[model samples]
Target: MKLKKIGNVEANYSFWQVLVVCSGQEFLDSGEDLIASFEINSPDVRLVLCLTDDLLAARELLKSLAQKLIALSMYELELDGDVDDNQRALPYQIARNVLLQTRLPTLLLESCSFVRRDITLLPAELQKADCALKLRFNRKGISQKVLTNTLWLLPNSRVDRFLAQAISGMAKTTSENEERKAVYKALQACRGFLKVAALPGRYADRSHKHEGFIWVRLPKEKAETTAAREFREKTRARFARPPEVIILHPKQDLGTKSHLENNTFKRRVERLARPGRIAWRQMARLLVELSWERGKPARLVPLPQWKITKEALKNYEFAKTIFVPHLISAQLPHPKAYYYMQELVPMLFTVDRNGWGGVDSI
Candidate 1:
């Protein structure tokens, strides 16, 4: 919150810099919710909120949360007199201007969307490629479309310049649909210059329900289309793997009325909750073990005679209600399950070298 120096810059090759475009009260509310929901202080992650409106209340709100954010920063963008009435171009304009000053890898996000803790997964993926994008299958199923609002770009002069130019082109377009098409085209053209990686699942935004499930959800006609077949083959050839397909258990059919019936729903919940409880207990036990190793004073030693501090007990109880539910939901054949297993689970079990446990305990 105090802009404390996190770690030696030379030790890390890159830091995670997040950019949020804020204009209205709704955006501010979602941005605030994002801050409160997850532990965003990863030492290498910084959040930048770009304010484009002259809202005094918005400034006050962000100021109040300054102490709550460890690496939060703000930028005020001045609108030109020729700005259009629709204000559709404002987000891209702000992003282009900010790109000029961004030295580290940057993630562009919409203020209305909330990213879960799996946001950390992008940095590692970005490190291996020049850019990472959240691609979703279009309704036509001929090709995949990029979610422009949530994009990741590594700090390369060419990549940044190319993306900025494409965004600039999009800003000048009057048609909303054409703007998206223009950006998608731009990404395709620049693929030769950039090694692009796909951000799997709903890591970018919860609104992307079909992020990683497109392969499994495709209709037979769409799947058999020549374009769709070529797209699949090209993706596998380029990335050395097919698009991830989330397989729901037969009993846990998603978005189906039959599966949501009384008895079926109860059975499905019970099946997922069993593993959720086991994962929760294992997490709690690790916290207790770390607390003992740290030599913390125990308020009470429960059965098994393991010394558990009040802080650890409170953390465990809090996780039981919050994290356990998330864990269960993550395991319920959702598109984000693999992301949870890859990033969230290990993050929860990790014990920091500073003697403080990871987010699960601290």
Candidate 2:
């Protein structure tokens, strides 16, 4: 590959300065898995065998995937302790830790996502945002938001300002290694802070800040949290060519799940599934119970209620109370739902629920 220079920076080469992360082999099996069928030049992306102390484990995986990855660029990072709550703070803390240390902008992405186009290949709208998040629609409705999903692209400098402050506050009280676990644990509650505050539209007075945040929808073919950004990118590409709506009738609706028409319509809807019947039935009952107990108008927990300032968040009571009835969710987050019928919820934590248990996806 050859590089061209423009105004002192390498033209296409410098644009996609990414730090691809594999939290465990479970998160990203290999670098090639990320690009999948795409024809990505190795020079365009950087890879990391991230988040495990065991170097030998990292080395073995890299040795196997040598066809797609450079041996030198894939390095191991170890955080102390089990620190293993998939929904909590590991990925954010990992990104925050790396971002604070590095000068270039780096995004945290899982191993399963297919990069049909590289970050260097992105448009100006996506490039300039404070954070580019993948989003999913919750059960409430198309208009209702669940939470931000996978494949987050946050600026290293901006992450320093938004994420690291809280981590630093706790660093004084804990050992460096313990801080890794603590940051993630605290992040469970702290996520409410970002979802409510850092995310632009949760409040009225909050700034949209150039409409700089992105919340992309996921593909129907795979698991919801897997960050199938390529699906929507393909849809956007299709729109530019022509508008072709393929309508299907009741008889046209295939009785079979694998019919071509059914698949096409599924793609158009973007959300092919919803939560299980049991979960919905259970949720209805819980809502009834809440109504009886409150005995008045159902309280509204309008977010952005707490001032979006460092001091307000750093205060003690905010974390504990954020998810209380009028705050985030109304229902007592009872037993974990056995399986979600839809793939709406994101990785960090489920929306509206305060406790740190994960909602299983269909």
Strongest candidate by TM-score? 1
Clashing pairs in 2: 274-341, 274-342, 275-341, 275-342, 276-341
Global lDDT of model 2: 0.33
lDDT (tens digit, per residue) of candidate 1 on 60-132: 7666555433222333344555443435556655555556655566777666544332243345435566676
Give the C-alpha lDDT of model 1: 0.43
TM-score of each: 0.50, 0.37
Off by over 4 Å in 1: 1-14, 38-44, 70-86, 137-144, 174-176, 205-362
- What lDDT score belongs to each candidate, Candidate 1 first? 0.43, 0.33
Give lDDT tens digits, candidate 2, residues 96-167. 665554433455555544443222223232434545442333344322232323333444444455455534
Candidate 2 ranges beyond 4 A from true positions: 1-16, 27-32, 35-43, 53-58, 67-87, 135-158, 164-362
Residue 19 of model 2, lDDT score: 43
Q: Count clashes in each candidate, considering only residues at least 3 apart in sequence or on different chains.
A: 1, 5
